[model samples]
Target: MRVKGEIDAYEVMAVNPYKALIVPRMVSGFLITPILTLIGTFTGILGGYIITVMVQGSNAWGFMGNLFNWLDMTDILGGIIKAAFFGILVILISCYYGFHVRGGAAGVGQATNDAVVASVVSIMVMNYFLTTAFFGFNI
Candidate 1:
C-alpha cells in the first residue's frame, strides 16, 4: 500500500518511478531487519526454554549445557543473515508488485497475493542457496 501510494502519487511527477517505489522499502528493510531478527531470535530461544524446561520437565541446567555446547556462533549468525536477506527479498518483491498494480482494488488484491507467494518462494529458494553457501553438507 505504501508503494502503491508512492507510485500513484509520483507516476506523473517522478523522473524514476522505480526508484520512488523501491527506495523507501529498501531503506526500511535495512533498518528493520536486524532489530526484528534479534527480537525473533531471543523469542525463539525463550519459547524453546519454556517448552523444554517448564512444560517437558527437562533439567534446565542440562538443557542449557547441551544447547550451548552444541550450538555455535556460526549457527546463530547464519540465521541472522538469512533473516536479513529474507527481509530484503520480501520488501523488493512486494514493492515490485504493489508499485505496478493496475485495474483497481482487484489489482491491488492480486498484487498482494502475488507478493506474498513470491516472497515465500523466494525465501525458500534463497534459504537453500544460503545454507549451501554457509554450511554446505553440515546443515
Candidate 2:
C-alpha cells in the first residue's frame, strides 16, 4: 500500500497506520506461531511413528511408550516459546524495514531482502541466548 499511496489515503482519513498495519501482524504472529508450532509438533511425532513403526517395522507400543520418556513438557514449551519469540522478531523487523521503504519497487525488494537477512541473523543469535536461559549455562 505504501508503494501505491494507499497508506497516504489512510492517513488523510486520520487512520493510524501503525495500528492498522503493524499491530495486527504483530498480534497474529504472537498468537499463531505457537499454535502452528503445536500442530507441527504433533505432525512430527506422527511422522516419526510412521517412519519407525510402519516403515521400519518397529513395535508401535514401544515407540508410543518411550515417546513421553524421551520428550517432555519442557521441550515442547521451549519450542513454543522459541516460535513465539521468533515470530515477533520476524514480524517486527519486517514491519520496520517495510515502513522505511523509499524509492519504489526496487526499494521494497531491498527492504525485503534486508529484513530476511536481519531476521535470520537475529533469530540465530536469540536462539543461542534463549536455549542457554531455558536449559542453563552448563559450560
Candidate 3:
C-alpha cells in the first residue's frame, strides 16, 4: 500500500497511516504467534505419536508415558514466549523497513530483503537469550 500510494492517500484524508495499518498488524502478530505455536506443538506431538505407535510399532502407552515425562508446562510456555517475541520482532522490523521504503519497486525489493534478514538475525539473537533466561546456563 505504501508503494502503491494508498498510505499517502490515507494520510491526506486525515487518517494516521501507522495507526490504521501498522497497529492492527502488530496486534495480530502479538496474539496469533502463540496460538500458532500451540497448534504446531500439538500437531507435532500427534504426528510423533502416530509415527511411533503406528509406523514404528511402539507401545502407545509407553510413548505417551515418555511424552508426559519429558515434556512439561515450562517447555510449552517457553516456546510460546519465544514465538510471541519473534512475531513482534518480525512485524516491527518489517513495518519499519516498509515505512521507510523509497526508490519505487527497487526500494520495495531491497527493503523486503533487509527486513527478512534483520528479522531472522533478531529472532536468532532473541532465541539465544530467551533460552538462556528460561533454562539457564547448561554448558
- Give TM per candidate: 0.85, 0.90, 0.90
Q: How would you encode candidate 1's per-residue C-alpha lDDT over 26-68 as one tens digit per residue?
A: 8789678978888988899899999999999999999889989
Global CA lDDT computed for model 1: 0.83
Question: Model 3: residues >4 Å from true position, as ranges?
Answer: 137-139
Residue pairs whose backbone atoms clash in candidate 1? none
C-alpha lDDT values of all predictions: 0.83, 0.93, 0.93
**What is the Å distance of residue 34 in model 2 from its true position?**
0.2
lDDT of model 2 at position 89: 95
Instruction: Output the TM-score of candidate 1.
Output: 0.85
Give Cα distance to truth, residue 69, candidate 3, Å. 1.6
lDDT of 2 at 134: 85
Model 1 Cα shift for residue 139 (angstroms): 8.2
For model 3 the TM-score comes to: 0.90
- Per-residue lDDT tens digits for candidate 3, residues 4-85, read 8888999999999989989999999999999999999999999999998999999999999988999899999999988999
